[model samples]
Target: MTLPTSDTRVETTVTEPGQRLLTVDGLTVSVGGLTLLDGVGLTIDAGETLGLIGETGSGKSLTSRAIIGLLPTAMDVTGSIVWRGQELLAASPAQRRRLRGTEISMIFQDPMSSLNPTMRIGRQVGEVLRRRGVPSVEVQRRVIEMLEHVGIPDPERRIGNYPHEFSGGMRQRAMIAMAMIAGPSLVLADEPTTALDVTVQARVLEMLRQVRAEQGSAMLFVSHDLRVISHVADRVSVMYAGSIMEQGPTVEVLRRPAHPYTKALVASVPAVRTRTAIADPLPGAPATPADRPTGCPFRTRCALAHDRCVEERPVLRIVGTDRLAACHVAEEVSR
Candidate 1:
């Protein structure tokens, strides 16, 4: 791996599918002495999907932003973010710019704000290709093909439409088209379906699944909805107070959570086939990184908290086969 630092630089290389695409280790982000993300680690293989699930302010979006180099200049970031074999933490602005849109793409939650209100959808989607020196005629053809692949109706007619002219779902499809136009190796989707209704949400999710299948691209899917994560993710990471509480195979972790926080989150999801009572809300306000406690970040809301939890922070450890949790009592409580 090439470790680029302030005084060193390296050339970027193309990575193939079925190989490690992104590796984040001990990623920490802070601004004005307030920590937003602490020691967060994640890995995504080419063509694999990793779901990041947490409540609002759990650092899920922050993690994605940090990876994509979208964080504010005031924020202090330290840690290793390796894409393919290149370290990104110390990479130059031009290096990151070269990677964005072509090697990596992001689909924001609100398409209305993310899409250019003044620009036509076709022009916006094809801009990346044109910037990379693709011929105008070929760019137009590829843009139309991508728009149709993402389920946009009447691509020929809608090509001239502006952001405001499309419906919520249609606008999101356009966003996906833009993100996929360059055939990025990694896609960061931060709650892309959160703003749509149930029917439209399902359709959009299906479209993403199809697109990933065809493109064979890795994805870091961030969302607060466990139901959505279950449908789309192969592995899942549970985040809280800027720390990862637990992570493992999606079905295994949900069925038998090892950490207290993961247990509470899984319990909160409603059952469909059987009649079940609503779970009681977790007591206390969600923890914030600015005022987080000394030890385990989830201890404030964890029923299993003890003196050990209060005095010493727990790092991620093996709780089961291919599973890891950051709780001292993980073995005792793991089901």
Candidate 2:
């Protein structure tokens, strides 16, 4: 079936290049007196995609949840998350709720868990608009049109189907449709293609790119795979032990990493276009946020770790043109 070319709910606006859409500074999250995300900071420009890349428990997801005000009530969060000049942390629960789905939407990691099995696909997809008091007929029409745009076969028939009725890839596309239906300014996609196979992964990635291009929505794309980040993000922030180790243009950071951990990560990925040999796995286990060392958390596994690294924590600093690296020997590492 053909894709939907236009929808009344999906509005696109022209923005100045490099305009700031979201700014997150010194974001920290803690639970039970243990810090999970420490001094994390990130920025997303208008119509730009920023990738948050790191291992699974490195606080990447925590950062996104904080941005959308989804953290558990027990957790203590301290930081500033500004969206289009408004501070999100200071906003009341009612205000945050209003912005959550309409202005900022998130695509969760697992579609099976995310999409309610009991709910019909059409109802789930159109839930946001329905909650906003949109006419039921219009919501149904838009949901079907969105399902078609996301490449679901015969969306008119499939709209009445349940979550289990669709394949893993199709479920994800429905998730995308749900996120995009509101025409959100910022989309936080947390490993949106992790469950799919290689072929399906490629298709989902392409669809995401097309959707972003059409809607002009800025994205915070989080994934553990650097290769995936290379394909999707214009800029990337590499996390290690709840802190950003490196942040810069994706191509530059991948080409010549400015931190030892980043270097090791790059070396571990097998080159597809070249016959380059992949480096041996890193020596030590990844550091956890709660059990981190006194100085740099990555120093335990870093080959370049020195006496200075043990005594002092390195904060993120400008190491190159538009590049920020948190390393004691950043100058030497960049060379």
Candidate 3:
């Protein structure tokens, strides 16, 4: 396998003290004897956004779920989820519950499922405050403020509306307001822009960017859109099947990806046509997690796959400064 040469190495600076917010270390997940995640590691620093991009079924959503303790009871997790020096994965139920809304929050992918149709929009957002024993009056005040903060114009008139009463964009805004009501320090957004019109998609992306900047929360923005990730991501991680294929600063990784799967994903973006005057959508769908080939899950689709690639699995290792890639043909890919 192609490993980083000594000359290619560059020293990395550790961020300022007390800035590390969330960490997922060697996180492994299995369901019904099927390994869904194979030792994924991610760290989100305070006030930075990490965009995780991949095709569907690449375990992006599962990584989000695993962090929030929302993974199904049928699955087993073997790893540590540390937050501010505490091991959250092993925290007691009450401790986990306490940390959930006050310290960490998740804006789920689907607004329809995330919201309560029976609950008024204002009440839904206020639930977080109420759970913390804040007075009802304060909850109402904070919920309305959040509604206005999330770009729901004239929030006072719409506070009583239910989920079904609002348009898709409005509903999504409300969901954002709810997740962020308590002013948590970390947010996980899973496909926050899916199914929205282009204009609304841009608006929602702007809203998320605003909240993260104003609140200074570390964020993990998960999606399939490299173009969208390019807009708001400080760092980018390209995932394949169930493992990270390549990761680095957004600009560097996007411009010179060292993994074939990552290159294929970037080339498949429709917007790439406008810039490069050509597009090559990745052929074939992703391999199922349960049936991935032994050597490398992506070898079947990689253009440069060789005999060694098909016979031995490649592990993620340093390829450049602040960069890691899992591919036997890393040198060929970089060129």
Best candidate, TM-score-wise? Answer: 2
lDDT of 2 at 46: 73
How do all the candidates rank in terms of lDDT, highest first? 2, 1, 3
Best by lDDT: 2
Record all residue pairs in model 1 with backbone atoms less than 3 Å apart, i.e. clashing.
none
Which digits, one per residue and each the tens of the lDDT, describe model 3 over residues 42-80?
Answer: 888888899999998999999998998888889999988
Clashes of 3: 0
Model 1 lDDT tens row, 270-295: 65112277665567879886689999
- How many clashes (backbone N, Cα, C below 3 Å) per candidate? 0, 0, 0
Tell how far residue 205 is off in model 2, in angstroms.
1.8
Off by over 4 Å in 1: 1-15, 272-277
- What lDDT does the true structure give each of the candidates? 0.84, 0.86, 0.81
C-alpha lDDT of residue 324 in model 2: 97
Query: After aligning candidate 2 to the native by TM-score, how far in Å is the CA of 163 from where it should be?
Result: 1.8
* Candidates in order: C-alpha RMSD to true structure: 6.2, 2.1, 8.6
TM-score of 3: 0.91
